[model samples]
Target: MPSKKIVKTSNAKKSQKQTKRDLKKRNKKITIKKDNFLKEKFLSSTANLLIKAVSIAANAAIVNREVGKRLNRRGKEALTIVSQLAVDVRNDVKQGVRAAKKIQAKKNGLKNSSKTRVRRLSA
Candidate 1:
C-alpha cells in the first residue's frame, strides 16, 4: 500500500482575502491622491483668473480717467473761445450805435461849426 499525502486548503483561502484587502487599500490611496491633485489644479486656475480680472478692471479705470481729462481740457478751450467772440461782438455793437447817433445828429442839422471841429480835432 502507498501512503497518501493530505494538503489543507485553508491557507490558500486566507491569502486570497489578504490580497483583496491590499487591493482595496491601494485603490483608496490612488483615489485620495487624485482628489488632492484636482483641488490644487482648480485653485491655481481660479487664482489666475482673479488676477486677470483685476488687471482688466484697472486698465479700464485708467482709460476712463484719461478720457475725462481730455474732455475737460477741450471744454475749457471752447469756453475761452466763446467768451472772446462775445467780447468782440459787444465792441462792434457799441461802434455801430455810435455811428448811428452821429448820422441822426447830422440829419437834424446839428452840425458842429468848423471852429468847433478844429477844436475837437486838436483835442
Candidate 2:
C-alpha cells in the first residue's frame, strides 16, 4: 500500500480577515491625508481673506483722513469769509450813521440861519 499524503488545509477565514485589515489600513491613511489637505486649504484661504480685509480697512482709513482734512480746510475758509463779511457790514453801517448825522446838523444850521435872516429883513 502507498503511503498516505499529509495535506494542510489553508484557512480561508483568516486570509479574508488579513485582507480586510490591509484595506482598512490603506483607507485610513488616505482619509488622514485628505483631511490634512483640506485643513491646509482652509487655513490658506482664511489668511488671504484676512489680509485683504486689513488692506481694505487701511485704505478706507487713509481716504477718510484725507476727506477730513479737506473738510477742515473748507470750514476754515468759510469761517474766514463770513468774518470778513461781518466786518465789512459793520464798517458800512458806521459810515452810514456818520453821514446821516452830518446831514442832520447841516439842515438844522440852514433852517436857523434862514429864520434869522428873514427876521432881520422884516425889522
Task: Find the candidate with the highest lDDT and give its number.
Answer: 2
**For residues 12-119, could you state the per-residue lDDT of candidate 1 as single tens digits?**
898999999999999999899899889999999999999999999999999999999999999999999999999999999999999998898786544556667888
TM-scores for all predictions: 0.62, 0.68
Worst 10 residues of 1 by lDDT: 107-116
For model 2, the stretches where C-alpha displacement exceeds 4 angstroms are: 1-16, 111-123
TM-score computed on alpha carbons, candidate 1: 0.62
Which residue pairs collide in model 2, if any? none
Q: Model 2 over residues 14-76: C-alpha lDDT tens digits? A: 798889999999999999989999999999999999999999999999999999999999999
